[model samples]
Target: MTRFQSKVALVTGGRSGIGRAIAKRLREEGARVITAQRGQDTEFECIGVDFNEPEAADDAIATVMQLAGRLDVLVNNAGMMQEQLAEEMSLVDWTRNLTVNLTTPFALIKASLPHLRQTQGRIVNIGSTEGLGSNPKHAAYCASKAGLHGLTRAIAIDHSHEGIRCNAVAPGWIDTDLNIDFIESMPDPKAFKQGLGKIHPVGRTGTPEEVANLVAWLASEESGFVTGQVWTVDGGRMAKLSLPG
Candidate 1:
């Protein structure tokens, strides 16, 4: 599917997990892929960046423009999840979550606007199902992702005339190393893992590639009319009513 042939894409945090999957999908669809991640070793053209820094977003965009010559798709995929209750969540953690999950994507979009405008490119933000609803002890994460979805809509509205489309994908309980690490860190990893599938109506958690495929479609011209939307790929989890155990 050479839908992205002759295109260039920059994916944030493309070294592993969901971001990595998205990058691979874009590449397989024929886009030249550039990745901004913390590590130096990567198969894709890499930019070493720490999203915690305020300048990281702009710096990444600049690097991509210099190396790749142009940007056709921007995937704001790097994010942090701080699982803390509102009562126990520190100011530092709250601010960090917003910075990484919300502010960084905004900065990247702003920096890449000119180039994307030239190419009529697209932006796919990796939001979470938690943004649409809530979970126990995920106050900071939910708030930040909610802000990210808002940012997605604003960009879509503001840039549609410029030929840039912005949309977000909200994933639920994706089976990734990061998610596995989170589950393993739990007090009862086995029970948590065992029970995770039943929550989704599909009877299984989503895979990174599943989310990646949706992102690829959204990034392509096939979804040209889809913008300012938050698409949830949650294995039917969002459709089910929450019932007491």
Candidate 2:
């Protein structure tokens, strides 16, 4: 319920999809939430901080402290995904992908560590099932997410002694607007959508709200014993073996 009555959370890219769901859920549970994104958002207390500039993370945290007075939860949800084959991907493209997905989160976490130490806060990183397995044309994306998972564990091991907890949520095929639109753009839209669901044992894709639930729990005090773990919330897709069609 009001476990976060006096707590403050910073959720990057909280303007849409999974990020929006996370921010909303945390706010619903009584946390004063600030969202950071590349563009301005009127719904939440938003700060425009592009992950492209990792230095922006420091400024963002300073802004959060000025606005909220303290930080209790840091949600590194902002990221990018570009599907380019390894051989075709330019060095610039490869670097940008890693910068947004991995480097920025690292920067943000580093900037927040001192404040988090003061409050004994938690960090929830938004990773992907790609971190656990490979996807076509996702060389950089997969590598970035895998690195993020590793970063999560390292942070937990290094900071748990300081009363900080770190964890990551690896989601697969969440029903976000971007995903729905891509599915709808297919020649056989209905068939394409069905294909997406069939990959999972649950017979459907996941929802942003489903992911938010896990993230909220991880960031809560109730998960005090939980740290250095990557929780997969992928509708059993990661566990089921696909049969030959």
Candidate 3:
């Protein structure tokens, strides 16, 4: 699907995990992809910037414009999670969560808007199902992601008239390296894994590629009519009611 042929995309944190998958998918669909990540990226041109210093997003956009000349797609994929209850979580940690997940994307979108206006480009934000529901020790994460979804809609409504569409993908339980590591750290990894799969209607957890596929569609002209929405790719987990054990 050469939907993105001749297009250029910038994916934040594209060096690994879900971001890596999104970049790979865009490249496969014929988009010239650049990544902004903390470490050097050998697979594609990378703009090294830590989201903690969100001012870097502006520089990243500048670097992309200088090198790629035009940006057609902006995938705000880099995010962080600090597992602490709201009571125990310090103000600093909570602020960091908002900074990395919500504020940085806002900065990236703001930086890319002018270029996206030129190309009538698209923005795909990586949100989480937790934005729609609660999770233990995820007070900050849920709030940040919910804010991101709101930002996504606000951008779509304000800028779609300018030919740039904005949308968000709220994914659940994707088996990225970080998740795998978490699962492995469990005392009974196999048992925990089995229970994790059972929570989803698909009888298994999701993969980064699956999330990337939806992102690809949203980022392309194929979904020209779809914007200001949060699409959940959760294998039906949210739709099902859990029975108490």
Candidate 4:
């Protein structure tokens, strides 16, 4: 369980939901975790900053290097999804989605390359099933996550020789706080949840802990040979094709 005894990890948006689970899992496995978030306080070593600002990426890396000295894992888990029709989504909304979901990870990767190269560290990007497919009123989210998927592959190929491994974890309908809130707000929460589970072959949605477990393996040496891959931890949702009932 102490696979990361000597490792230092940076998890963006680690204050809540999927990112929080990732940070907790890494810490449980004996890694010294540093969480970066906007206006949220975490029990772990945290850096409060807005990743939406382009410069925050470099600043966050600098802070991590200063605090931990060596970085072994960079989990780009912070992201936001705004729901709007393609035609209704404004330039600002589109830009915001891409900035947080795609560009922030790019900036972090660029800034961490030197340190990661030194440590032969790994990068685990928290992508989404939306990237692989599409959803109603999710144009911006899908586009940004698709960009993130491409970025993961590019980084894996570009830095493989340097001992850097980049992979993405694409999750679908995880039962996170954000998701729960949205589901509860629906007119028929029970029916909504049941419908979601029915669509997935596993008969249920996934959890943050499940996704974190996959991330831990990918970040650790156990998955040393894996790179440039999009691993879906979606309870087989992506593999199933629905038929008329």
Candidate 5:
């Protein structure tokens, strides 16, 4: 049998990028996948949820429970990032980043905890390398992701005895629509990509599939003992530092 055979997974922001890749991967591994996004789509059992809204987490959880009766895995993959230095960022931008990145995930996990505990399920939080270290023009993004790391650990510590495992996957410089759009908006798109690519020891950006694979494993029985850990899949980006000239 497949690793995730007979499992039910609810993935947030599953319409695109890493979330979409994770949803597809879960389905391929024999899980009945349900997706929640701001827009509807026929590709899967999609539930519309404006994650920016306060009630969206509860609404999405209700939809998932109505469809599957139980949630065996919750992938909190929905998040937003703003590019602004600490000095330039406004309260609105900072609040929005935290709301989307940190608050929403916490709400989703809380809403799903009962069902997850019943099934001995897992929570896989999609974090970022920025959570672990500094980045230019990303104060809000970094802070929010770092907060997620703390939240993930808290969940693991509080619920591990109940058979619910919580872990985080921090990806680095993934090549996704978000990144592509940012690059395309630049004056020299090719140069932007190349310059960004060079920072990674692997000489390339990580793929959504690679991140998805790690998440899948963490959510499955293969990682049954793992909890409260932050796994980094960054192409060695966080391991190297630039030397002084």
Candidate 6:
């Protein structure tokens, strides 16, 4: 049988990048996927809601439940990153990053909890390598992702008896549009990409499909015993402190 046969999944920020890949993979695995994004209409059934808005999380969950009848898996893959030093970062910038990256996932999980409990589902939160270790000019992003890691553990402990699993995936540098744009905007795009690739023990960046595959396994019965874990999918970037140093 297909891993996701008869399963229902909701993917936040499913318009592009990793979220999009997860949604597509879940659907291909026989899931009924409802993707939610801000103002983007996807090929699959999707809802338009800016997660930054007050009512967006609730509305997105309601829309998914209405269409799918139940929520079997929730992928909290929506996040934002701002490049600014601590001294230069404003309260608004800090709050924006937290609200979108951390708070939004909390809200979505809260809203989807009853349904998840009913179905005994799982949650796959997309974190970052930054959450594991600090980097320059990423204070707010790191804090938010770290908080998400904490939240994942809390949820696992609180709901394990109820058969709900919660986990996180901390991806290293992937070649997504965000990274592509960032590199293109640099003076030497090729060097920028090459430098990031060399830092990884695998000697290359990761792909969205690779992350999606891990998520699919976690969301399936294959990973039923796993919970409260933060799996890094960063081409072994987090494995060694210094690569070939």
TM-score of each: 0.95, 0.98, 0.98, 0.98, 0.94, 0.95
Over 4 Å off in model 1, which ranges?
A: 182-191
Candidate 4 structure quality by residue, lDDT tens digits, 136-172: 9999999989999999999999999999999999999
> lDDT tens digits, residues 81-190, model 1?
87777989889889988999899999999999999999999999999999999988989889889999999999999999889999999999898997889899999998
Count of clashes, each model: 0, 0, 0, 0, 0, 0
Each model's lDDT:
0.92, 0.95, 0.95, 0.94, 0.92, 0.91
On residues 34-80, what C-alpha lDDT tens digit does candidate 5 reach at each position?
98888886778998888889999999998888988999999999888
Please identify which of the two predictions, 1 or 5, would achieve the higher lDDT against the true structure: 1
Stretches of model 5 off by over 4 angstroms after superposition: none
lDDT of 6 by residue, 1-245 (tens): 38999999999888899998999999999998888888765477888888879888998899888887899999999899998999999999899999999999999999999999999999999998899998888999999999999999999999978989999999988878887898899999899888887888888998999999999999999998999999999888778677365
Report residue 49 deviation for candidate 3 (angstroms): 0.7
Runs off by more than 4 Å, candidate 4: none
Clashing pairs in 2: none
Error of 4 at 7 (Å): 0.7
Error of 5 at 158 (Å): 0.5
TM-score-best of 1 and 4: 4
Evaluate model 1: give its TM-score.
0.95
Q: Which residue window of length 10 is worst by lDDT in model 4?
A: 37-46
Question: Which regions in candidate 3 have their CA more than 4 angstroms from the true location?
Answer: none
RMSD of each: 1.5, 0.8, 0.9, 0.9, 1.6, 1.6
Q: What does the lDDT read for residue 211 in candidate 2? A: 98
The Cα RMSD in angstroms, rounded to one decimal, for candidate 3 relative to the true structure is 0.9
Error of 4 at 181 (Å): 1.2
Residue 3, model 5, lDDT = 86
Q: What is the alpha-carbon lDDT of model 2 when measured against the actual structure?
A: 0.95
* lDDT head-to-head 2 vs 4, winner: 2
